[model samples]
Target: MAKCPEDLLLSGCFSSVALIMIKAPAPMLIAVGMYLPFDTTFAVFVGGMLKLASDKFLIKRNADEKQKTIVENIGILVASGFIAGEALTGVLLAALVLLGIPSITSLLTGQNAFEFTGSAMGGWLSILIFGIVILGLIRIPLGALKNKVQ
Candidate 1:
């Protein structure tokens, strides 16, 4: 008797963990990619590539094992923070909607709900903000390692 989706366990619906363990990201990409702009997908791809490249660079660096471990731990913490921030933002936006306040999206876009990519200026601004965030992500971990070494 699951009233809400939150209460409904996958265990109850699925007979075994094997079915749950099967990830189908291709189906997800096919379903959602149609609705997203090429810029969005390209940006995601670039971010993933940067992640892979950074991982390789870190492994090849001449830092001692302890320092590398510190950097790795810092990276994990930064990534966890990013994920938590996203979740918290979603929750805050939902709370704003429940409270009848304009969510950040409508506030930023105006009453017309203008898409950020609708104009060149908006698109560039979005890119600038995204770049700044990526810079911050890289900076924080590096700063941590620097401090640990000093």
Candidate 2:
């Protein structure tokens, strides 16, 4: 027989408590990541890799604690801006959809927009853009550190 939602909820609660008792790190985040879609999780994985790279970059540069803190702060601000911008853009697009404007380009050009989104080239373009964003994530903080020294 399939377990009821109450049973599942209780099981989850017990498991979480067990993990906490075991001194597990980020147990809740790990559990939530397990349930998230692959694309969402993959983005998180990429972010983790970027963070690793940033830490390595700082070590390679022999950054002082103050420099490291400055870079960390800049990185946090950049990440926050990215999150806010994505959320705002999503809200704006949803509003447009609710207003019966399906595609902004189509509204302006009287034709279907984003036809490339279904093609292989579109996939490659997405990868390229993702790479650019990743580079920005690494560079922007380090760049700020450089500017602060002058």
Candidate 3:
């Protein structure tokens, strides 16, 4: 009986949650990865401000909105839509990474890296570099995802 995906409960919920993440993942990464040498509660506050600025940029650009109701609602509803759309971007980024990395197939299957055997630092550095590269890889998908949801 649903007219569109918006009417379905599970689809709606997941999509909504994705919108939130899609909107401000960088702020989130910073909050989680860096201590910022200050009060942790301030992290949320900082994220909010960054998002506020993002929202303005989004608005100033004159983005095409399928639904007017969503623009007016702001806050949670709009945020969720962005996150939901970004989930697809995240998936795409993962795919691109797998294609780009020669050892991806082995890594996924639990085979360790060649450089990993060199030293303790080698293994540790590989993991660290991998994480950093993954973040960089995700940036494009995140941008694409933002456009899709919005």
Candidate 4:
């Protein structure tokens, strides 16, 4: 199932939207089934920041337990990694754009590759076609190797 365009614009995070599509659906469906949207990287980062800030705000909050401290520290580090990775990807994107390669990462998959769209297909249809192409490219090499082994 496709995510409506508005969700993409509002969140500024496409991980669940794309992963719910091209990568995994069952977990996403289960999350949606529970009426809780999966926390995107943005949401998680916000939550992590708030977790720390809110902890600071409340004087009554208990002293940070060992496990909680580990978790919060890890959260901060993970958030930093996500920020760094995004910056690096943007720099790479600018380089690719300058070279005139159609190198945009699809919101559906974080890969850099050319996408195909048939003349008659709508935009969403083109993405489905692109997924099939990606699957084939992945499988054909495996198939060839299997034949050689046989």
Candidate 5:
């Protein structure tokens, strides 16, 4: 006898959202926080906020049609870079696993990445990194605009 997907999904064992979340294209599902931990979801949310702030800056400056186009293009370029980077990283990690790389995560992080948690120092470091990336997203296009004026 075949089991129904909905029966399995809604049997009070799995949450409704989890049942509906995408299963294929795991990377995207993880990136969007549908099938992964909250940290990634939080990061993605913050990136959206950064884009919002960047758009606001452009509006505040009264950017013309061409300027608006340039800013939007820069945002797209940055987002593309992020997606490419994630894909490359995933491929590299997969290859390492296929090649029997020992303790790959530890090798990359000296096993400290997971241990350095719940500390103010770690929290501050995370904030600093997040700020830098967000600022870069905002500044790169603004810099381009400045160059155009020169």
Candidate 6:
């Protein structure tokens, strides 16, 4: 008797469940990374790196419990705001597409001003902007510590 594709899929699902039941997360993380788009995974990787950097900075500064709590709260708030903004932007863009309306950029410029987005210079500019954002993430919380100290 030959096994069907459904049987193979079911076995895969069972194996995944077993992995989870055994408290193993590496396989799950690998599976999710493989399933998600490159940009999505890259964003997650960047976020993880930012978190690591933040932790290291805090340790190097010899932050106390109260200081660490303040920084953590500020970071969480900032991250939440970013997540909300991104979600809202995504919804707005999706609605515009569904309504057959031009994007805000096109409406403002009377054309696609982002045509250069695919260029090498545009990529560099994006990286520079992202680096600025990363710096802000690291500095904003630590800056709060400074204010509290003074």
How well is each residue in 1-150 modelled by candidate 4, as lDDT tens digits?
976888645553455566567767355543443444554443444444556553563334353454345445544565466568779999988887787756555533666444444345557785686466444433443344344445
- The residue pairs that clash in candidate 3, if any, are 16-80, 18-83, 18-84, 19-79, 19-80, 19-82, 19-83, 19-84, 20-79
lDDT of 1 by residue, 1-150 (tens): 747664335534452344346765454454345447997677557656656765676677667778767766776687678779989998998998898866566666656464555689788888798788778667777678789878
lDDT of 5 by residue, 1-150 (tens): 976788655553454345456444444434346555788677777777876887788789887889888877887898789779979989988987888764466777756355554677779888888788777877887888878767
* C-alpha TM-score for every candidate: 0.55, 0.87, 0.25, 0.33, 0.61, 0.77
- Evaluate all candidate structures by whole-model CA lDDT and list the values in order: 0.68, 0.87, 0.54, 0.53, 0.73, 0.82
In model 6, pairs of residues that clash are: none
**Most accurate candidate by lDDT:** 2
Between candidates 2 and 4, the one scoring higher on lDDT is 2
For model 3, the stretches where C-alpha displacement exceeds 4 angstroms are: 1-38, 66-142, 145-150
Across 1-150, the per-residue lDDT of candidate 2 in tens digits comes to 966789768878888888899988889767777578888888778887887888899899999999999999999899889889999999989988998987778888988778887799899999998888888888899999999988
Instruction: Give me candidate 3's TM-score against the actual structure.
Output: 0.25
**What is the TM-score ranking, best to worst?**
2, 6, 5, 1, 4, 3
lDDT of 6 by residue, 1-150 (tens): 976799767877887888788878577665667568998888778877887887888899898888888988898788788889889999999998997767677867778777777799889999998898888878888899889978
lDDT of 3 by residue, 33-88 (tens): 44355564553554466456545655776655532223334444444555576798
Root-mean-square deviation (CA) per prediction? 7.6, 2.6, 15.1, 18.6, 7.4, 4.0
Error of 4 at 48 (Å): 5.2
Q: In model 1, what is the error at residue 127, expressed in angstroms?
A: 1.3
Lowest summed lDDT across 10 adjacent residues in model 3 is found at 66-75
Instruction: Return the lDDT, model 6, position 15.
Output: 75
Clashes of 5: 0
Q: lDDT (0-100) at residue 90 of candidate 1?
A: 89
Clash pairs, model 2 backbone: none
Point out where model 1 deviates above 4 Å. Answer: 1-47, 104-119
